[model samples]
Target: MAKRKPAFVLGAILLSLSFVVSACGGTGNGNSPASPGASATASATASASPSQAAEETAIPSASAAAEGTRSYETDKGVVEIPAKPQRIVTDYYGGELLAVGANVIGVEPTAFDNPFLKDLLANTQDVGYPTNVEKVLELQPDLIVVMYDDSYEALSKIAPTVHIPYGTATNIYETVELFGDLVGAPDKAEAFIAEFEKRAAEGRERLKGVVDENATFGIYELTDKGELWTFGDNAGRGGQALYNALKLKMPEKNSNDNQTLQLSMELLPEYAADYMFLTVYDPEKKGEALENLQASAVWSNLDAVKNNHLFMNDFDTFYRYDPIAITEQIDLFVDMIVERTEANKK
Candidate 1:
């Protein structure tokens, strides 16, 4: 979400969360989620996909439409997908599949880079960016999950194609449970939820003293174009960890019912919080703009910034919010927040 014009680009590619969080708080075990979901009960319009805005119901799959396949309801149309998809190809939502123990044969190149899901996708084929449609056909996947409908006609002709859309996957657990139903893995989905909650609860205990009840947080990115990009809960950029899993809060003034907001830097004071997470977008390529801002008086004087409550995060590391991604994020995120806050206090 760097160098983006406010009205034009909502944000960047969301993050992928992949590490496993265990009930006993032991590290290891399992993996990543991405593409956001809905938990705020915000209107469908508020949670529309960043790229395409269509229906708000958000894609959902259900019971037998055919002898071997089931009906998956999407905003575009009802697709008949396999009751148990054996060969799956996903882009951002691959983490959701992994959480439910679904067999994902292929994913876009980005999924392979996801630390949380990378090991799990060790053997998974790289489907290419813009989703190499040709590579997908060769993979002979039984089902395809996408964030958009651009290749719907082509992909659907080859096999059942379901659109989950971006921004719509904000409700992390709800969306994962829905994916479990979509893949006929309800039991696995339940277990994912159980373990994630247990782990997150443990994380909350860690933040008890560091984060108080009224403390507010903000997920922000200083775009190269001089815009302030703000994100909602579970909308990636560590949102799942800070706002959802650890149960932190975003300032109501800057927060809205939707997934993103790109506003002027002058509004920083209004959006200021007790603590802040700031990302420089794609720093290597677009960091000059942020450097200029950091030198400005406005940037130096923000409440959070002056108070040493500002923390930096890489754009890609914190973009994913799948069950797997969020689970992996808890311990790491908790430790980072605690360590950073403690250091600043000293």
Candidate 2:
């Protein structure tokens, strides 16, 4: 059995899912049973800053208010979202909301969702993965968000929808800023980034003291078809951030061949790298692809494999690229790899 590509490969699958537009109103006056936490009297006090006001134009079609944040008046309805939204509904990128001090109204069901969103989930509705417009409408979200292209249309119909377009090659920072401005939470966004940068700096400080900076890491997916799919700078995947943001090294053996290569199972041995990042095709289904890779002779024999340096990560969280999430993610990655690599040397 071959190894599957990185978790970002699911981007292709989600892209194939159907998307639709929705019908809605400007203000949701009548409360549904599942509506988000009511807008408190303090809701009117939520305002934006001067810098936030100046940059409001960049947010997608959203208009700035006197308070500094932006609002959207779409054909479906009007959304007076905060300059930085406090209540956020998401498909897979709900982690971004946490970074910005916002409350998570919903998230895609997954392990990452559980730890970060456990308390919020009790009251939050499951609009379903990629977002269910019907549930979104009932939830009366301040902002409806999705990470894939699949849920765009239906989400837009339900409310003021924002697409994160998560994948391997996507720039996480740019995606983060876009969301930041849209929700009128640029300050919170900036704060999260600062914290992330601090962690990244600490990682870099540690790395610079000892090992060679030019050392490379290889990311690949082993497939049943005997293929070795290597991810590159432009490849949309969660691991791509480690390269793009942290400036991590990539193995020389992993060439510029960013395309998913169909290798014979015999060649899986040749594709093994110094450090491997593992991902499965459809984790929602059978774990066969992953299991096969673990059991393969070629996989067991690799230097990285022998040393136990391969890193396993969550697909849904990693694949969705957002600035806040990206920083948080790479920090974790750097620490994990650095700790593992050092431990192996000992």
Candidate 3:
């Protein structure tokens, strides 16, 4: 992926994640799901499409007839989708639409900086973040793709929105397929999933036996409160990807905070894990940010720190569930961690 400018543009992507944890994480993986069986639960609107595409420009929104056909099950509920849905609006989950050959009429603009979505961003309108219903409705989207949360109320006012809470997919490909079926773009979705799987398989082969598979890893974020907060299995960023996809280990004592924790600056050392993927709060404040975290004695004494196995990941890639960016980041992460760990043993 090409590097993004202003550097902080990437920060915007990472900052967008705070909303993901809050708006998306309600039904923990263990809970019984809410009923998607309600017909009133879905509403479909209409939007623009490419002339060259196989599907028509203005198909029905998912809300029109909830009884027709459902592509797949989702965290929010069953994603009853229209076959060949047109005029899709998405937030957070851009890659899903792209895979299914669905032309995006609009998506939350901030997700564009992901580099993977640059082309899509150029073609579609930016309706602000997921909950910015005013701008989204202006596009007249047939379906608004969103993570299920407090934002659902506002999105419902705009269109027949599909709410897929995060954590439905274990990896990038699974994520793509889950969303693709929801929008009736399964063929395109499967193609994208195939490409991602190929890349991941290649990466796994390259890194195999290079690092200890049993070694634990940690996913963390920098809060506006100026503290480094550690994330658990089902919470933020790499949470689901790490636990479900990579199958790596984690520290024994982990908390279940759907909300981002504010680990005070003094407790930086508490974040130590076998491998630490650091997400800085603000890239502009890097000098001071690194200094503050480094001042803690616990930070310096960690095994990963002493061996220099820590990775400073882009906020957008590490802190949120953007499938395209996450796949790229995972490959980069596997390569670095494996190389570093093997070098340490030597």
Q: How do the predictions measure up, each by TM-score?
A: 0.78, 0.63, 0.66
Clashes of each: 21, 33, 8
Could you tell me which residue pairs clash in candidate 3?
A: 43-63, 43-160, 44-63, 44-160, 45-142, 46-141, 46-142, 99-188
Ranking by TM-score: 1, 3, 2
Tens digits of lDDT, candidate 2, 1-346:
3234433344433432110000000000111121122124213222332122222322333233334446655433555555544456777655445444455676665514433234434655566664566776777666676655576676666656765444411233433344455565565445444444455566677667544575566666544433346555434334434655566776664443332434555765666656677654463556677777678887788877776878776544444343433444566677777788688778
- For candidate 1, lDDT tens digit of each residue in 30-144? 2235323333332232222211111111122443324387678898788888887777887656777776667787787777766677656766898776778898999998899
Worst-scoring 10-residue span by lDDT in model 1:
19-28
Task: Put down candidate 3 lDDT per residue, 127-232, tens digits, no spaces.
Answer: 6754567777788875777754557767756666677665555344445546556666555444444444445566666666765777768766654435566665
- Local distance difference test values of all predictions, in order: 0.64, 0.49, 0.53
The count of residue-pair clashes in candidate 2 stands at 33
Deviation (Å) of 113 in candidate 1: 2.2
Better of 2 and 3 by TM-score: 3
Candidate number of the best lDDT: 1
Model with the higher TM-score, candidate 1 or 3: 1
